[model samples]
Target: MVANTQMDADKVKIMGSKVKVDSIMKVADIEEAEKQKMKRKVDKILAYKPDVFINRQLVYNYPEQLLADAGVMVIEHADFDGMERLAAVLGAEILSTFDDPKSDVLGSCAGIEEIMIGEDKVIKFAGCQRNEACSIVLRGSGNHILDEAERSLHDAICVLVSAVKNHRTIYGGGNAEIRMSLAVHDLANTVEGKQALAIEAFSRALRQ
Candidate 1:
């Protein structure tokens, strides 16, 4: 299951830094209330019986221990974009609250395990229900190379997606740009105003 809520002991909200309670017993009551609130949230999550828990926010030690004890693999602090992509791939819902969780809302995968990629450990989810969705991890010796690689990869993926969606192909090697430049220049010649200069300049820029 994918969740965005922070998995931690709930804190009591007071108006000021120092509050005078009716009795010392009130302090104990407040602490117990916090515990109960956290326990309830944990219980609600466990009721779903998900094989793995993916949280977009932090999973504090207390609740983390409980989830660990339940034999549920916990992945915490996943960014919003990642959670969205993961949920899509897994065919799961992004649930902020586990209350009244739908039976079919959980995502499925063949397995999840920690794997070493370069010097870092990453959790790999295999055999997602949405076979079309996949993740690629890029590694590089330097940040600049990695950034450039990522930009190139993004452009490539966007092109691929556009081609797939439109079922069309175009000429490579700046052929399309040259064609546009030629078309714009042809239009510029027929224009009878100062806008012709702007159009001609744009055409030349495209050619370059």
Candidate 2:
């Protein structure tokens, strides 16, 4: 049984990594849940738990979906119409959140891999990969974020994407990889700026 702690981390790593998720998740369904809990949401969940538990089903009375697969963030089918959705969603963050641009970015994103539900498809989630010091001002090589909403959106995409892109460094299923979908230097301080950013992002997704 995988812990919920791996949820968020797995999401980003998978989406960013370059691998085949459908084949991997098709084989490993259970581990996918475990990855999501530990990678993305456990720490946040534990804060409410006060004490951890056996599976993602918390012993404490907290939002169960917080650990369930439904809560995991993911983007689907990056090869087709998915890229546009991913671009705005993944690149929604700005420089303040470390979504900045750099020449040394080995890969646009950094994260793990896993699978998803409803369909027999695996995915790779990306955007703002995990780091010891996870924030906007990470090293030259770092995934970034801009705001809380963007972070949440990022997590959602990570879940779906991660299952697609498995780790190449490993044997069958490894970490995933993703690239910057969009780049916004100055986020709108005014209500319109914020709205514009969102509109632009989704618009780009529609275009793709």
Candidate 3:
């Protein structure tokens, strides 16, 4: 199954510049589990995908496409801003006895597919609403880029799937939609080479 969502700037203004979104999902091990249960789970997700994408991403992120989809969108322009969202996915299938087990799951990018926009201006975002807080990196320091990207990637309706709140992933990450904000690169401590340019870009992006 697949889902698409988008958000744009104008709608953002009317709906308010900021939209609040928070979710929780439960992931269970399907190993040794029955067939009917698995079918039910898949059906549940496909059903809710549309509702969440429309109601949530639409009012928030405000991408040029105006709808935030599972795939990604890369727009090109001189006045470009960069946004990367890291979503946490739960991998385990069966084993539902535990409401919230200390297990790990797989994650997917909220921008499931990549959709290009504009011949010059580009904006991108990613999300992980399954079992982890996706990491979204905003480039160019565009004004509130982090918040903008986060809002764009909040697409999944049932993806806030919860594993043990503090459960670690197979790669040593947590299982929650934790939002961490940062610039294209770290410049606070390092001022070498093009650090000045990077900083300038960040500053302009922040103010722009």
RMSD of each: 8.7, 27.0, 26.0
lDDT of 3 at 60: 31
Put down candidate 1 lDDT per residue, 18-65, tens digits, no spaces.
867899899889978887888889989999998788999999877888
Any runs in candidate 3 off by more than 4 Å, and if so which? 1-33, 50-208
Judge candidate 2 against the unseen true structure and give its global Cα lDDT, from 0 to 1.
0.37
Give the 10-residue window scoring lowest on summed lDDT in candidate 3. 78-87
- Which wins on lDDT, candidate 1 or candidate 2? 1
* Better candidate number, 1 or 3, judged by TM-score: 1
TM-score per model over all chains: 0.73, 0.17, 0.16
TM-score computed on alpha carbons, candidate 2:
0.17
Compare the candidates by TM-score and give the number of the best one: 1
State the weakest 10-residue window (summed lDDT) of model 2. 172-181
Best by lDDT: 1
* 9-28: candidate 2 lDDT, tens digit per residue: 33334555664556766536
111-146: candidate 3 lDDT, tens digit per residue: 644345433433233454454433334454566886
- lDDT for model 1 comes to 0.88
